[model samples]
Structure formats: C-alpha cells, structure tokens
Target: MYIPELYKNENQEDIQNFIHQNGFAILVNQTDGKLWATHIPLVLDVNADGKQVLVGHISKLNPQGESFKADDSVLAIFSGAHSYISSSWYDHENVPTWNYLAVHVYGNVKIYTHEQAVNSLKKLVDKYEANSENPVRVEKLSEKTMREARGIIAFEIEITSIEAQKNYPKTEMIKTIKISFPN
Candidate 1:
C-alpha cells in the first residue's frame, strides 16, 4: 500500500480497531503471475509474543487461495465508508474529490491443517458468534470428514506490517475541514 504522509495512520491500536470494525476484507495474493483477490470475513488473533495473526476461510471451490503457500506473503485490504465531496459542498469553488478510509495489512499466510483449522474456526466463532443472544451452533464432523471438507483450507496470516491510510481531501473552499478520531 502506497500511503502518502498526508494519508498515513500511525497508531497501532487505532489501525487494529479499524480493521476489527471493518472485518470484511479483501485478501490478495499472487497466482500464475497474476493477482488473486477474495472477499472474506476475518478475525484477529493476538499471541503472547506480539505475533498478530489473522484467521479466515474460503470456499473449496474458490480459486483465490491457490496463490498462497505457507511462506507466501498476502495482503488484506479493509475499507470503510466513502463519499464524494462536490466542489459546491464547500463555500468556495474547489476541485471535487473523493473522501475515504482504508487499511492494508501485510502478512505471511501459514496454511492451517485439520486440527489447526478447527481451532481457528473455534476462535472465529468465539469472536464473531459469542456476541449473539442465542448460543451459536457449530457442526461436529469426524476427523476424516473434516479432512475431506478441508477443501476450504483455513489459514493464519501472521502480520508482518500494517499500513493504514486516512484520506481527507482539502475542502476549505466551502465548509470547514474537520478530521478527528475518538481519543
């Protein structure tokens, strides 16, 4: 992710929280000399060693995951709300541009096998389903069946670096520019 100084987000906690709030992300990897991308909901897993990992699953029929290996690097791009600001919106005659917020995470995609994928799924349920009022139901499958169903391979992306960028276009021509994130 190429972030200009004006659009850079420097806070680690803020970036992490932003991703959490916008967990639905686009995971990108390389395949056949081309970039493969998939949209998936992911959960963050933090380890004691400060090793931050991301867990997510893709359908067995999906070809996007084929681009990655245990040591291959992957990129997850998260997007938030965005809108177009018209020049007329400002009091002055300013050039129109778009305003948006986004974050891109770089990591190593470590493929999780049978047990590891199950653990990752459990953790994902805890993170996403635990908030519901009713108890979440998870299907239990035999090891052999699970292994066969592993067509949808789950993986843990150990985050190597995070690059968050906030784009705030200059709109002083009409309305006052206000950019603030909760403290």
Candidate 2:
C-alpha cells in the first residue's frame, strides 16, 4: 500500500476494471489477536443504496468467518501480472526490479442474512457461468447441491477506499526495446 506518487493510479475506471478482471482477491482482517486472510473470488456490486461493495463468501468452518463483525475493517488485495526487469535491459548499469499491478481495497464488513447470502450466490454463479458452453444456474441446481450453501458464510464489504498502483516501464521505452530486440 506504499505507492510512490509516480506509480499510483488514481483513475477510478481503471481501478474498477482491474478488480473485475482480477476478481480473485485476498481478504485480510484481524481476528482475535491474530491476522486472518482468505483468498476468494469477490464481485463488485452496487447495493440498493447505490453504494459500491465487494461480495464474497467463505466456508462457515473457517475461523476467519466466525470472527467477522459488522463494521470491522478489512482489506482486499487484487494482484495482476508481474515480471522481473533485468538491469541488462537498461542502457546503463542499474539494479534489477519487479513490475506489477495491484489494487488494495479497504472496507467494512457486513455479514449477509440467509436470504441475502443465497441471492448473492445466485448472482455470482450467473456472472461466471454466463459465457460457458453448458452454463449452470443456482435456480436450476438440485436441492441437495443447494443445501451445501448452508455451510458457507456470505458477506459484503462496503468499500471505504481504494489504492491502485502500476509499476512498469514507460510505453515508449518498451516499444523502443522491442524494436531493437526484434522479437
């Protein structure tokens, strides 16, 4: 979250797109006296109040889920492609570095009710299965399969802040290098 001014991306549109493209994010929060983290697919949505939120779920057996409380602060990190930039790539001597894109979303937790959780799960399924050749839907799922939902805890994070960063070579520099290397 320590983004240098030069690497910071303040474009809201780009940040949202990044989150959508990299929907699997690491959710972090403090539980009891220790830090808890869960990697899950989170979808961005607008609530009935028109406030943006991130929705996701975790196994009910997960300790992280047991400790979640309304208004508890949490962090969701979405990471994108990264690669090592060798010092040899530069004309002058320089240290090697890594370039990547990432977005850190801060929010407050809001546990969903049973009905709300089911609805959220339905939307999540529909979103991912939309383009599948044989798409499956929550409404069409068998009762036995749907009963498994009882074992999970769905929640929403009311977004409070977002910090996005992209650390990469300038476009012209990359183009020039590609032209020189002919690859």
What overall lDDT goes with each candidate model? 0.76, 0.85
lDDT of 1 at 115: 75
TM-score, prediction 2: 0.91
Give the winner by lDDT: 2
In order of appearance, the predictions have TM-scores of 0.81, 0.91
- As a whole number from 0 to 100, the lDDT of residue 21 in candidate 2 is 86
Which pairs clash in model 1?
Answer: 90-174, 91-174, 92-173
Record all residue pairs in model 2 with backbone atoms less than 3 Å apart, i.e. clashing.
none
Which residue runs of candidate 1 sit more than 4 Å off their true CA positions?
Answer: 137-149, 167-183
Over the stretch 1-183, how does candidate 2's per-residue lDDT look in tens digits?
Answer: 998898898888888888888999999998777888899999999998999999999999888887785337899999987777776777666787777889999998898988899999998999899999999999999999989999999999999999988756374333234222100
Residue-wise lDDT of candidate 1 within 14-107, one digit each (tens)? 8888888889999998867878888999888775467888889887677666666523888999998776766667876679877778888898
Which 10-residue window in model 2 sums to the lowest lDDT?
Answer: 174-183
Model 1 worst lDDT run, 10 consecutive residues: 174-183
